[model samples]
Target: MGTIDQTTYTLTCPQCLQTEKKKVLDKGSNYGGSHWQEGVDFSEFDVAWAGGGTSEPVITTAVCKKCNVPPSIVSSYS
Candidate 1:
């Protein structure tokens, strides 16, 4: 086991276009050669709301400081 190299990646949400800072663990970008995923994976869920729903996918991985976002935090920039 080794340490993880984490980086602050400022990304904007695709749907809401909200800017949020996400900590990404680049195992491939490690000092040595750690080829591991971000220890975490963003779960996907079907987007459906009032009236009807769109075919688009609503993935929970953004922390909108304002509003118009999912009820969750901690995610990677897709």
Candidate 2:
């Protein structure tokens, strides 16, 4: 096992455009290691992931707490 780090993710609600930040565990080496692993904490949000054949886990559904909507995505850093 590798060291765990913290990563901040920004999410937005598609319905009301509300934004929120969440910190999750980022595993593996950050300094050019061959292996890297990370995951999204589903307990933090009402979210779902894409299934099958993909190289990585993709966020398929994310619900916003304020708007009760399910169109949230990991926002790009500014």
Candidate 3:
């Protein structure tokens, strides 16, 4: 099989209002519990593992050319 280069979005934290890039994996697998089966597919599940409760704007450091803000002053709001 050919190797594929996966791309990811470096997300920032929304709470503290800091601009930091985060690297995330593309694919992941999770095992079921007693009430659930081991081989059961968790794709249908809508569970939030981490960084789920973000209520702020995303980092604007890499803003598009259409925006008026400068890249240096741009901030990532999670």
Candidate 4:
């Protein structure tokens, strides 16, 4: 199986000024490989994947639990 990296970040809601913690997975060399099939838990936030097809996928946006407003990614770390 290929290695999977996990990254955590904070997302802030623009409408309600709320902050939430989120996690994302980096398939790295596994990219399109099917070594893993587990679902990621996003808790109380909504997330979207970006930059697929030609590049690595990244979590770029999240939905705020407070007002249901989608927020931009603030910062992330492995």
The global C-alpha lDDT for each of the candidates, from Candidate 1 onward, is 0.38, 0.53, 0.26, 0.59
Per-residue alpha-carbon lDDT of model 3 for 1-78, expressed as tens digits? 221122233322333333433322222233421121111111212112222112222222343233322223222222
lDDT of 1: 0.38
Residue 24 deviation, candidate 3, in Å? 6.3
lDDT of 4 at 14: 82
Runs in model 2 lying further than 4 Å from the true structure: 1-8, 23-26, 29-38, 42-44, 51-54, 75-78
Best by TM-score: 4
- lDDT-superior candidate, 1 or 4: 4
Best by lDDT: 4
Please write out the lDDT profile of model 4 over residues 1-78, one tens digit for every residue.
344665566767788776767554545364465232232446656776665433445666668676787876665556
Q: Between the candidate structures 1 and 2, which one is better when assessed by lDDT?
A: 2
lDDT of 2 by residue, 1-78 (tens): 463544455777667777667544434455744322334554435766553222334567678666677755663322
Query: What residue pairs clash in candidate 3, if any at all?
Result: 59-76
Q: What TM-score does candidate 3 reach? A: 0.20
Among all windows of 10 consecutive residues in model 4, the one with the lowest summed lDDT is 33-42
Candidate 4 clashing pairs, residues 3+ apart or interchain: none
Task: Quote the lDDT for 39 in model 2.
Answer: 42
At residue 26, candidate 1 shows an lDDT of 37
